[model samples]
Target: MPEKCGTGLSLLPDVPRPNEPSVGRFGEVLRQYNVRLWAGADLVSVTGTWMQVLGVNWYVLQVTGSSTRMGLAMLVQALPVLLLGPYGGALADRLPVRRILVVTQVLHAVLAAALALAVFADAGLWAIYAVAAVSGVVSAVDGPALGRFGGMVAGPARLGTALAFGSLIHSTGRIVGMAAGGVLVASFGPAPLFLWNAVSFAGVVVALLRVRVADLHPLAAAPREAGAVRAGFAYLLRQPVVLGTLALSFVLGSLGRNYQVTMAAMSDGPLAGGAAGYGLLSAVFAAGTVLGALVAGQRAELTTRLLVGAGLLASALQVVAAFVPGLWAFALVLVPIAAAAVLLDTTVSARVQLDTREDMRGRVLAAVGVVGSLSGMVGAPLLGWLSEVAGPRAALAIGGAVCLAACGLAGARLVRRSEPAVPAALATA
Candidate 1:
């Protein structure tokens, strides 16, 4: 929302200022040996992760052909985060992150391998759910640890750039993984995708082993305490801005971001296509995310205004997308929708990192994850039912409208807070 000087176009906020370094300053950040190694490993691991995700959703749709079932699958995956994310965060604050991540990566690899075996042996839905449940538990711990460790990769000075680069790779991986999964699923089947994911963990494991632990800017480990989780919650209660950002994430994540369920339905039913089409759509969405992340990384500061504006714009785009007549057109609209989504996410993440003490960052992120997961647990099945009853278009339209209304109310509150107060007598007169 920052107006460019002498330019008529409305440019996004957080663009590098005149005094800022080159737009591609992330290149310098990559010069750090540890960051470079981790980035390479992370890219591979993330790509595999997306591949497995698409494979699972696609398989569920194939077997059940029910949007509700797909939602259930998503719900199962998110339940652990809601239940255990706080404990995970506390552990992250107390543990050596590298050691924790190595164990997590191994656990994921084993899970992926098991999923592949189950699918190959024609395992029942219960088997799939069991794997998902276990994986979710691992993720509940792994998520916070990975998040905290990611910031330490490049240290605080280049944290934004490093994060931006991470987002870029993540999106790029999404694009590659989705496209490849589509092809793999169409030709061989979902089993190969899972197997491939199992093997993909090796890259991250190797990178973790190779990282120079001494180079890390580690936060002091929090001492053992009886009510650590409560303490973390108390800290968030005192930080209104952080709480506001998390609230936005929950609203958007629960209602608007269940694309795994919605998009699958959209692809097969409305778009009249299959897994390949879903992959193409995923690629386009991820492309937008890459652009958004790049723009976000350039900005040295993040403000509430940026977060609100991005949320509003993203919601509006979703509403517009709900009405698009064709798949290609819907894909076109998805770009900006995704861009806004990434812009909002990256800005909030950067703001959180900048504001929170290093020791508390993991716990704060855990709290945020819990909110998102709690919302998703309810929203996924609810939205899926909406899709079943009202159709995908209606689901999209309604969800987007809800998000838009919430963003509008939040933005209004913020604007009122920022407005200069008038004297009571003058207002009455």
Candidate 2:
């Protein structure tokens, strides 16, 4: 077991404590009205986002009736992040993040609305893929800016709390959106869900407008240079902790975290579930994430051990969940799976924010996004192919096995780093 600080939570180590007098771990962090306000708005937008996500998945599944196409759609979405995410991170360093955020949110709303129009007009698969590709482009840039925007709103001192709350809000939104998305999509269609997401984007835009710029502890804009992206890469390579975290993220993200694909396949293939069934699974998963985020929030420190342990545990749960005989039984097993997943995910995110310099935060996160996207690029279709060949059960088993192999490899690397080198003279003697 990892040792805990006096705060009595050590899911990750060395998290800076908030000084405000409050009873719980998040008390001091949530006390900031701006942070609270931001979280509230974020919750609204995230709910809508999840609704669209579920709609997209279900729509594709209905249209193609093939998990391979579902994986391909996801792959299209990841391409931009894999290619342009670093440049986007560099731009985040030079731009007013607030403005960037507002603009991006608007773009997202527009794209969602456009997609709704296309779907309503009975657009072709190519049109859907094109819209998805464009959405991915916006996300490549939007992701880094949005990530570091939390620090700008809450100040560096409360960054950990801000991130924790942010994840919690996202999970909350997931629960609502995923739960309702199925029923709504079943009753209405994907059109309305897309429009709902468009409207939801307005919430974040308004919240961003309301934020007092003077209150922000903004980092000085990084000067434009040819080496900007490269510099960010070099800086990240030098940090062992961040490097380890990213490595874990790559493996876990690829093998275990592509749940949109995995869950869809599981629902369609094994459970013979419809929209409502997928929604229930999504909600159950989100519920576990909320619990995990709450527990992770209380921890002031994040460590590699926690990252590794949580990942291993989540992967193991996936293995167990694959063998469950019934839908309810599978959902029951998903609670811990979601908890472990959230813990691993939130820890890596918080660690990246906490460890990276304010000026470089966006870029580093962008680089991380690249790795994650690359993993998804490979993992999504690979899992889909596995499912297509064998079955959903086989896909789950393969992913879990890959995760276990990654953890073992990472563990071995850590062990090798810790061992003493043999002396040449002593060896000769």
Query: Whose lDDT is greatest here?
Result: 1
lDDT of 1 by residue, 159-273 (tens): 6567667788889898888789889999988999999999999999999998898887666567789998888788777766567667777888878777766777788778876
Task: Give the Cα lDDT of each candidate.
Answer: 0.77, 0.76
| lDDT per residue as tens, model 2, 1-429 | 111112112322433433423246566566667777788889999999999988888888889998668767778988888888988999998888889999999999999998799889988678779989998999999999987777667664555445666778888888789778878999999989999999999989998999777766565467778899899888787776577678878889887988867887888888877666776787788888888877676655445566677888888888887888877888888888888887777667766665566668789889878888887787877888888898999889889988987877766554334223211111100
In model 2, what lDDT does residue 101 have? 90
Best by TM-score: 1
**Local lDDT at 400 for model 2:** 93
Question: Residue 158 deviation, candidate 1, in Å?
Answer: 2.3
Residue 264 in candidate 2, Cα distance off native in Å:
5.0
Instruction: Give the deviation of candidate 1 from the true structure as CA RMSD.
Output: 8.3
Q: What is the TM-score of each candidate against the true structure?
A: 0.84, 0.83
Residue 387 of model 1 has an lDDT of 83
RMSD of each: 8.3, 8.0
